[model samples]
Structure formats: C-alpha cells, structure tokens
Target: MNYRTILITALSCALVACQQTPTKPHAPNNLVTQAPALGAPVAVYTTAKNTEQRLSQGTTLTFAKSVQPSEGEISVFVNPHKSFQTFIGVGGAFTDASAEVFAKLPQDKQQELLTAYYDKEQGIGYSLARTTIHSSDFGSHSFTYIEEGDKELKTFSIDHDREFRLPLIKQAIDAAGGELLVYASPWSPPAFMKSNNNMLKGGKLLPEYFESWAMYYTKFIKAYEAEGIPIWGITIQNEPMAVQRWESNIYTAEEERDFLKNYLGPIMEREGLGDKNIVVWDHNRDLISQRANTIFEDPEAAKYAWGIGFHWYETWAGGTTMHDNLYNVAQSFPDKKLLFTEGTNERFSRDKYQHWPNAERYGHSMINDFNAGTVGWTDWNILLDENGGPNHVQNFCFSPIHADTRTGELIYTPSYYYIGHFSKFIAPGAKRISTTVSRSHLLATSFQNDDGKTATVVMNQSDDDIAYNFIVEDKEVELTIPARAMQTLVY
Candidate 1:
C-alpha cells in the first residue's frame, strides 16, 4: 500500500486505542541486592506508524525493578557504562541546491527552514554538516574557484560562494547555536587537472598535477575560513570508485594512498592546515575495507588521515547493505574512525514525500552503522527543490526535507523525523553504549551524552504492534511500540 494509505490506517488504530497483549510481571532477578538508580524519568518521543506524531513527546516512563524476559517477549537492554565509539554528530549536507532553494524561499520561510534543522529545541538539532568544495551534481552547473589553466595557483578565490552558499552556511552555524562541524568533499578536481580534461565523467588526476591538486585543498580551506566558516574536515574524493555522468574522479585504492602519503598529507601540514581532518575513501561500503586497508595500512598515509568516510549507495545494485564491512574496518583499525559521509534515498518523486520506507532506510542504516562502529552519520542534501533538485545533470534524489519554491511551502518527509530520532537527543561527544534486543523485528542503539543523559533509540519495523521492556542496569520500564514506528527514550 502507498504510504498515505498506511498512515491513515495507522492513525485510525491509534485513535481507537489499538490493543496490545499485556506482559505478566516476572520475578525480580535476584542477581543484585540493589539496582543502580536510573536517574530521572525517561521522556518518550516517538514517530509512530500511521500517526501524525513526528518526534512528538509522549508519556514519561519511570524505571522499576528489572524483569526476566519470557520467551517470544521483546525487550531492549541498554548498558550505558559499556560504551563504544564517541559520537561526532548527525546532520545533512548544505549542497548548492539546498542553498539555492533557501535563497528562493520567503524570508520567514528561510528562517523557519533554518530553525527547523538547526535549533536545538525547535528543530532536529543537527551538529554536523557537509558541502561540496566547489561544485557537484547538485549545483546548477560545474565551476571551479580558479580560472582555467592557471597552474601557477595565483587565481584562487571563492567569490562564487559569497552569493548564496556562504550566507546559508553562516546562518546555519548561527542557528546551530554558533557551532556546527562542517566538512567538504570534491566530486572532481578542475578539468585541466584531470586526464579526460573534463570533470563530468570519471577520470584520473594527472600525476603532474598531484601537488597542484593538493594545494587546491589548502586554498579552499583558507578561503572558506576567511569567509568566517571554519571547515572541520575534507574527504579526498567523493565516490572515488564510481564513474558517473556527473562530476567524478577515479582513484584506485593504491593511487589514493600514494596521493595522501606523498602529496595531500604533507602539503596540508606544510601549509599549516594539518589540524583539519583528512578523510580517505569517501565512497561506498562495498569496497570500504579494501580502501581503508590500502590507505590505513601505510603508516605515512594513515598518519594524516583522521578517519575513513563512506556512503550508502553500494546497495544500489540490489545487494544488501554491507554493514558488516564497517565492523571489519573498525575492528582492524581501532585507532582510526569511521564516518558515514553521505546517503539519501535516490530517485525522488514528489508524491513519495510521505514514503515510509525512505525513513525506514535511514533508521535501518543508522542503527546498524552505529552498532557496527560509525562515529557520525551525514545525509546527502538537507533540502532540495520540489523537483528534487536544481541538479546540473538532472541527477535528482530525495532529501529529508524539500521546499516547494513555486508554492513557497516546505515539505518534511518521514526521513526527517527518522533522523531527528537520533540527532535531536544524542549530542556530540556522546558515546555509543551497549544495547541488546530480544527480537529481530525491533532494532535498537543507545548513546550516553556528555551531560550524562542516555538516549536509547528503538525502531519497530514489523507489522504487529509489540510490547517491549526497556531495561537499563537493574531497572525496567514496560513500553509498547506500534508497528512501523521509532522511539527515542531519553532521561
């Protein structure tokens, strides 16, 4: 069934008070004489199946004595003390299309959109952001910062960004309470620097221009900083393995490693941009292991790399998402980090704004990725036009939120609430804690924020409403999750 129909059905059930099987109280686990205090009561915020609730605050839950799980009864157990990776943050990209659309919206709508995404209380509280270095397929056209054939590296400027992109980014930083970790990635280097002399198709960077290309990154970083936008990090290339119709560059595993070790790494240091994170293999999960191994195995190359960045498009060929690959990389390189750089539901249709699966796609990935050891997650475009984009090559895709520039209205997709389930409650510097679920239908992940508050996210994708016990340490809270819903229990 279509999403709207499903949502209507779900809402009807909610209004009528859908019945759930009750769980009989079980004997307390006598393993502990006293269970640790679970702090304040947990505030439940949920986005439920077929309901208008989008991150809507629900009933508060107080922890009681722990109960033993009965067979077939679903339960989520969270261990906040046992933590894994530190969470960087969760956010979306500020692509040219997003910026351009923002520029077209009415003044109040612009503020509304910015507030909807960045305000800690009113919005989703995004703490991370990504943007293209110059131009990507999401831009209106391909362009470079410098004039063509200026190999002397004297003509660098970012005047193009001052018009629309920079303003939006600056406002976003302000809306985010004056702090947002922003990063950039290049789809392709300038045409003159590539073998094909065009940035549209996949082409290798000519060996002669390696140093110049390395210098380009430093220039971009400095220019943006001068514009009052601090660049937190940058990926060497976006989707280095793919050959697409839009801007793309090819770099085999070995080639990317060499460029970092011998060129990009040292240049950034010499230019005093060493503090900026250098991420390698901003590609997909399918070959993330190969790319991470090749670059991270080399001490020289690995030294400069802050982490490995990846995308979610590897599943486009109808293959299962290679989530285990992320675990393998994390297990292999405990010192390095993993960041989900970019991902969005592709092939956007205006009618599918309420599409439930798009949101499920996000919940599924975020849970698995965090469980598998990813520090942060980034969605591709924060906002796109009604057409799904003003994309240069018409490579349209779905964003969590889209603006109908023609109508001056904003559309918040289910994906937006799906992402908010995590980003809103889990602050940066939060650490992933251990969470065990008793059923496969219910997926869960938990994080303890720096402020000592723990947020546990549980997603129910099954068709049947499920009653589950939320357990932490020796405390338990009985909860019921509607079919195809997600909840973030925060205390």
Candidate 2:
C-alpha cells in the first residue's frame, strides 16, 4: 500500500498512489512521562499486539502506526500542485567546520561524508547555502576584506577568507557536481567600514563605505570565482536590524533602500554581476510590514531585487495559519519570492543540550515554513561543536550533526534526520502541492518531482499518536502516526 496515494486528494483528474483510506482513525494522543528515566523507556506500536501500546518513545526511537507491521509496501506519487521553486540548504554550520574538527574524523570517513554531501544525485542533497562573507558569530572570529584604518584606495582584498573557509567549501561543492546554490551575506562590515572602529562593538555601516563596500563585495565574488565557486544569490546584510556584540551591523529601512538603490544595485550592474541576484531584508519574519514598506516604497531598489528574505526567530501569528512561521508581509505583493534565509535551534536556553534530541522542533520549523509557501528553506548552522559552537562570545547552541571536540565522535541529531525527510526526497526542482490531514497536529505538504511523481511528507511532532487519512484523487487510506515522530508518507 502506498502511503501517499491513500491520503492525497488531487484537485483535477488524478490517480491514487498510496494506501490511504478515510476509515483510518486518528492516532490516540499518548504521553511519555514519569515512571522511567528521561530516556529509559523505548516502545514500538505498529508491531504491537491488539492489547499492547502502539506508540512510544524513550530509549531507541521507533516510527510505527496502529496498523499491523507487515512487510507492506508504500509507493509515493509525485504530484506537485504548487507552482514555485527556490534552493534549500543549511548555512554557516559546515562551511566553517574547524580544521580541528575535520582532522579528528578518519580520512576515509571524511571523504565518504564529503562525497555523500556533494553527490546530490545519490541522495544527501543541499541545493542552497548561506555563508558569512567574513566571520560571523558562527565563525572563528570577526574580520573583513578591508582592515581598520585602511581608508585608502590601494588596499582592498579578501585575503582573510581566502586562506581556508572558501577552499574547504569549494571542495564540497565540487564533489556535488557543482550544483550548490550559494547566498553570501555579511554579518557586519569590516571595522573600518563601520561607525565603531572595533569589530566586537555594535556599529552601523558608515555611509562613507556604502559605495566602496559594494566594490568590496564584488571583489569577494570575483575572488570566489577565481576559486571556481559561483555565487547564486546574496543579501545586503545578514541581520540588518540586529546589532549584536559579535559580528553584526544594523540597517534601518532608509539606509537599506539608499544602499541598495544608490550603491549596491548600481555597482553590481556596472560590474556586470547581473546573473547573480540580490535579495532584500535578510532579517526576522516579524518585520514583514517594514519589508513591504521598504520594497514597496522604493521602485528602483525593489526593481533590482530578486526576492524578499526572512529569518524565523520572531513569531508572527498573522502568517501562522498560512504556514507555521510564515508572515503576511508578502501577501500584498506576491510577485517576489519569500525565502527563509537563516534559523537555528540553538537559542542560548538553559537546557540547550536537551533541545538537541527534539527532532520535532526542527521538523516543526521546516514544515511551518514550507506550508507558508516559502520557496526554499535554510537552517542557521549545519555542524557545530558539542556546546553548539566555537563562538568567540561563548554564546552557543547545538547543530544537526555534532562532532565531539575531543573524540571526533559524530552524533547525528534530530535536525539531521528531520532535514533528510525533505531534502533526501524533495530535490531542488520538486514543487510543493496542496495537502489536507485529519487534524491540526499532523502538518503536511505535498510535492511533485520533475517526472510528475508526487511526494507527500507529514510530521506528527505532537506528544500523542494522531492517525491520518490522506485523500488524493478522491481515494483515501489509513496512516497511524507515532507520537512525537515525523513520517515522510510517500506513494
């Protein structure tokens, strides 16, 4: 029985591809609380007898529904109903993986993993990625193309980043058949280009460097090209609104418009970097109004722009029903695309490590964005050390895959598997489609591959088992969702 065909309901003439019957009841809500240590109990349900508990989590994780555990086959049909496309990938995490971390892994394991990373045709796929033009909080330290006090015409080069980060990233991209999509952003301009003369202090980009900084970015792009890496997209600044002690700079709406309208856009056109696109407002989602205001207000700045970008840090309810963290900023103007540029699970909470095991959270973030019509999705950092990062400020969070600094032991977190559900099956060209579930706890989105085969991925991140009946083309089937587990039900 194909899981996807039973549940998907095609709007037009369609065929059932999975075993989804409407008669299947929603899974019962189950809770895993006291009586056992935090992670001591492990129970699986699909294989349980009728009198047994069907859904459980504690020790090893199991994904099973109430249905009998036969060797039943499920084939997912790719019916991409939505008409949109963009790149998807993780950012800052692996690009800046320390030499210390790389040296720890065995040469064979390292090569194997790198091959797995780039050989997208093989499965583990990353079509798009975000990188700091220089060092952001996720990097070794803060630096930029031009040094402080070098306000002259003679010295402007990206020699700092040229040393290792660029080369390391290029190696991975080269192995992937060179299909990686790169979007570069600056956490903060070099200290000399900022109001503050120190990289550690919060400062705004000085107006004086606006034009020269655009030139600086061109050089960075040219330097990477020299290394055989083509940058697909770029943002004016990382978080133009946030001014952190780490590598950060603030850009008010006025400044952003002036920079893009008067400086960056014109310079890119002059240098003939027209093929690579530029996106605006690479900041939080809550500022949709500000983004709409900025882009809508300026015809030229908006004209030269490719799309609008947002991060998932701040929650916006207006866009919630549309998609989990989606905002209504782009509703008025639907022509431009909305892409989630950066988000991470590490929020400096007291229980940072506990956050790592909750693959549901990462799953929630991805589905929320995808449901909201985000063209693509990208996470903050792919790989960070045990404490979340090697951040200079010591403010850290966990990564999808963590490498023990001392042992080199790799612990694949929930984020990794959560990403696999979408990335592994939904390649770069796949388009999202409409999907309806029995209840709200089970969030879902359907996609159609290039060959028109439909892939539907659903997540039951709630603590209880929620049975699902996916109807496509008027045919339905039963799918029992295990509690606190995510299932990619495809036909």
Q: Global lDDT for candidate 1?
A: 0.85
**Candidate 1 displacement at residue 417 in angstroms:** 0.4
As for candidate 1, its clashing pairs are none
Reference-based TM-score, model 1:
0.93
**Local accuracy by lDDT, each model:** 0.85, 0.58
lDDT, residue 475, candidate 2: 39
Q: Over the stretch 1-491, how does candidate 2's per-residue lDDT look in tens digits?
A: 22112112111112111211111011111221111122222221121111122111113332222232232323222222323333244333344544335545666655645543444444245556777777787766666666566655257666765565665577667765665777788777777777886665568878787877888778778777887778876888877877677777788887888888899989898998977778888888777567657765689888778777787667434443234224355454555667778777655443444343456666677777765657667777666666666687876866666666566666545455566566655655555554555456667666555444444667765676665554454233445666666555434
Q: Give model 1's clash tally.
A: 0
Give the lDDT of residue 366 in candidate 2: 72
- Candidate 2 regions exceeding 4 Å error are 1-100, 121-123, 315-327, 347-357
- lDDT score, candidate 1, position 32: 20
Best-fitting candidate, measured by lDDT? 1
